[model samples]
Target: MGHAPVMTWTVRRAGPGDVGELARINCESWQHSARGVVPDVLLDRMLPESYLNGWRRWVRLPDPDGVFVAEDEAGRLGSYCTVAEARDDDDIHADLRTGELIGVHADPLHMGTGAGRAVHDAALDHLAEQGFRYAVLWVLKDDWTTRSFYAHHGWRHDGATKDHAAGDQRVPVVRYGRFLNARKRNRPPSGFRFPAFG
Candidate 1:
């Protein structure tokens, strides 16, 4: 019923029923990422419930699109990802190459076991299928793991950074973008390399 183990997995279009697992993973990812700024007590109290309500609310939002959980051969959830349409001045950027990776998390219990890759592959496939050519996600400047992850996954920097409002504080985040329509070798010339540990 929950995330466990499997060889290959399935990724479906997420719906209302997915709120619970989605919430769980979201909270787990956030709680892990928001180490000091978010107090332990506050995270413990707010994360799970916030995830539940937030997923529910987002699922009901207009034109709100996202993929479902990646279920293993054992019929359990492994990982989850969501792609949101991005609004930008560049039509190419906004249309084929400009979606936002909103949430991507694997069950901590199942972390580093290919579940994350499965979810990522499924989400990218979904984006390509939907005619998206560019995609982006925000990552904390201080979080090397996630930054390294996106870099390893073929995402490149657009040379853009932002100070976004998170809770009661400002967080420095980097923007990682992928050009779906470009040649596979046409990546940003940052000369950055991140080893995919998975």
Candidate 2:
């Protein structure tokens, strides 16, 4: 049998009109990726309709450019990611300027079509452009596939962990972080002294 044709996708800022498609992609991704990991009862509730309101808030923001969607040439939305200021007070880099990659999901059907990575890259770029010096995201601890994906993209565990509320149950999750725009620090003159030492 012949191999499946390669697919290309374009990444763009999501708008109010794209909320429906984004919801569908989100549900489909959760259903497909969380099959064995999440309880079937809980996964069954991951319906597209259940995500509409939440997606609407993201896409309808005054500046929705922080939310990105990837569309295939066939005009189908296959993936999306939302990025914004870090929300959790316990974020690893609490004292530093940081951004959060709220979520990133790709339709199972578009797994190998670059849809996921396209939106992923777009989110990071947007965060950097918004002047975030660091970025963070949470992922299920047992989700090796996703952990690998983020690691491959320069994210590190940062040794932070938390429990995510999935329906009535809680799953252990870990935080990943990366520097969005790191620069070398300039050293003081040859013999600069600290105020305490001086």
* Candidate achieving the largest lDDT: 2
What are the clashing pairs of model 2? none
lDDT of 2 by residue, 1-198 (tens): 443355788899998889888888888888888777778899888788888898888777654148898988787888889898887766636444678888789888777667778888888888777777677799988888888878877787877788899999998999887777641221222453211110
Q: How does candidate 1 fare on TM-score? A: 0.77
Q: lDDT per residue, candidate 1, 61-95, as tens digits?
A: 54435665787777677678877776444322522
Candidate 1 to native Cα RMSD, angstroms:
6.5
Off by over 4 Å in 1: 1-7, 36-42, 60-64, 87-97, 182-198
List CA RMSD, all candidates: 6.5, 5.9
Q: Provide the lowest-lDDT 10-residue window in model 2.
A: 189-198
